[model samples]
Target: MSRTIPFHFVDVFAVAPLTGNSLAVVDGGGELALELMQNIAREFNQSETTFVLPATRPDADWKLRSFTPKGVEVFGAGGHNTLGAWWWLAAAGRLELGDGPTRFHQQIGDLVYPLAIWQSQGKLEKIIMRQEAPVAGRQLSNLGALATALGLNAEEIAADVVPCQVVSTGAAHLLVPIRDRQAVDRISPDAKQLFDLLNEVGGEGCYVFSLDPLQPGTTAYARFFNPTVGISEDPATGTAAGPLAAHLVAHGLAQPGVIKVEQGTTLGRTSIIEVGVDAGSVSVSGRGIVVASGAFSI
Candidate 1:
């Protein structure tokens, strides 16, 4: 007989509900098959969905797996999904108030995440993780063909910075720095052209960014497109935000510390993502609110 498993859906990186990236979480995923997990992730239709499995090591906290809607297993860490999973575990009473730090053994490697829970004015709040510093990769291409793929004119591209470069902390993305926020908002890339350019750049996807240093801590504005990976436009992307922060510091565009990223504005869903970079590794963290909780039979 099939048994229904409990799950929780959350909006990450938002202080309130409905403002950040959404993720679905299955709390106990020790026995689910990889194919079944992929199918469930596809049915959820989110940019990323997570399954919490049993940890082999007695000292380890949990074993987590992340999957995209396209059924591809993700390497490295995900910001919103991590936060969403923590929120679910804490709310369900599986984790205590002073659980200290939690270790997640992911596809990339083992990640240690510290938990912080506070009660202020009778409202409960939690911040589960800090991301590692970003790792910079080689510059790949210029703005010529990339501009064509992104539906932008050559003149509209940024000359000071090159386009179609690879950047990563744990996951790699082709970084495409645009000229302005307006150009970023108007982007509608041709799928075939985008796929070809991504292959040429040796990246799985592309991240489009523009400087929006007007905000006190915010250094840039960005939107990620990965039609090749089954996501047209990501509302808030934590994986991309890590490398974007590194790019800003490496290029001297922003200070080498904590920075804020604003995304999904053009898509009508605004999200604020925070990134902390120390030395070389980067850590991306944010708030997540539980939107719904239920169960499904496999």
Candidate 2:
């Protein structure tokens, strides 16, 4: 017998239907095999595809597992994949959201984190998730090799602004500060070289950014690339954005508050991510648009 699975497409951090990072959410996926889930993720071919499963623990309301197009199971709760999953949950009438902020727990990997959904007169306004505290990891020592891998001159990498380092809010990723947004946009990473560097540093992805943002009031303009997981580029990445915000605050480049990072302009997606950092805690908040829904028979 064949199984018919329902799924929805959400544009995370989007103001419009086609903008932001696209995510495919598979509903009622508790019983789906892991290999089948990976296959479904590949079929969707989005930056990330999420599967909604029943909560395995009492402290959690639901369980979410996300997989990349390359079949890598993403465990971090700080990314757009998990955010979009909960957005669909509330929008689909699965969760009872009272007016104002409602707290819910989500289980991703071995941990359960609290997430908040803000509602005004029963309308879901935004979803905010508190990520793990920031951890400033290894600093990339080879700017020359990194510059060549990114197809830029060594001088383009602005080590003076902030040293190229690996930081984690939920997942570890390399943060490369460029001189300006122009050089940030000019990045053309050699997949093999970039992958090797990331592997050596134990980073999952690379986030190249600059202080000059296209939008006013935004702190940074950035792009995401993860050859390790086969994501060539991501329009919006909450996991990376959260870490970047915390990193800036650690460097005194940004104060503790809601810092907005503008991303996806180079890819024409254009996403604005609001990251809040206060007293060592980091959170990412955004609204997602449910663009489409359908059933997959397999």
Candidate 3:
């Protein structure tokens, strides 16, 4: 007999549903094989999906596995997945508001998600998560060859943002800072070339940002593309945001504190991601809403 498993679809980093990046959560996925998890994620066709399993250790909180629609397992973490999993657990009554720091054992290592709920207008709000410290990688050369790989004019890139580098909080990405927002909005990457270059250099994807550091409230306008991983465009990318914030601070582009990043404008799904970096450690946080929940038998 086949048993049905309940799942949730959550929009992460958006105040309203369908505005932020969506993730599908399978609450008890320990019994499923890696191939099965990848198949389910591809069937859902989201940018990313998560599988949650019970923790083996008594002091552990939860074990999670993340997958892209193309069946590739992701290491480290994604901002939306962390929030989506917690929201599903809390809403299902498996986790309580006072559960302290919920631990997540991922392929990367141990990740702690501290839950916090607040009452506003007599309604309960879900907890927001702060990501762990980011790990920085080697700074690659920002030569003309790299620009060609991205289908961008070498002259269009900002001269001041030297050493077009690869950075990672948990996931590695190419940090490409453009001269202006026009380049960011207009340029389209040669997905195949970009992916090949990233893999050759041991990076996951590329993040392009137009610097507008002088803006009062906004820090930068950015876009992320990962065709190699089957994400044409991300509505809101929390994993990239953390390193972007660090890049901004390291390059003297913005003040070292909290800054707001706007993404998905060209895609018609506007989303805001907030990040904080201090002393080389980065933390990304955002609000998410549960759009739909249901069960499926496999």
lDDT of 1 by residue, 225-275 (tens): 887778888888887888888887777777766788988777767788888
- Per-candidate RMSD, Å: 2.8, 0.7, 3.1
Query: Which stretches of candidate 1 lie above 4 Å from their native place?
Result: 99-133, 162-164, 213-217
Evaluated at residue 10, the lDDT of candidate 2 is 97
Comparing 2 and 3 on TM-score, the stronger one: 2
Residue-wise C-alpha lDDT for candidate 2, range 1-298, written one tens digit per residue: 9989999999999868899999999998888899999999999999999999999999999999999988999987768999999999999999998999999999998789999999999899999999999999899989999999999999999998898999999899999999999999999999999999999898999999999899999999999999999999999999999999999999999999999999898998999999999999999999999999999899
Ranking by TM-score: 2, 1, 3
| All candidates: TM-score | 0.88, 0.99, 0.87
Better of 1 and 2 by TM-score: 2
Query: How well does model 1 score by local distance difference test?
Result: 0.74
Clashes of 3: 0
Return whichever of 1 and 3 wins on lDDT.
1
Q: In model 3, where do residues sit more than 4 Å from their true spots?
A: 98-132, 213-216
Clashes of each: 9, 0, 0
lDDT of each model, Cα atoms only?
0.74, 0.94, 0.73
Record all residue pairs in model 2 with backbone atoms less than 3 Å apart, i.e. clashing.
Answer: none
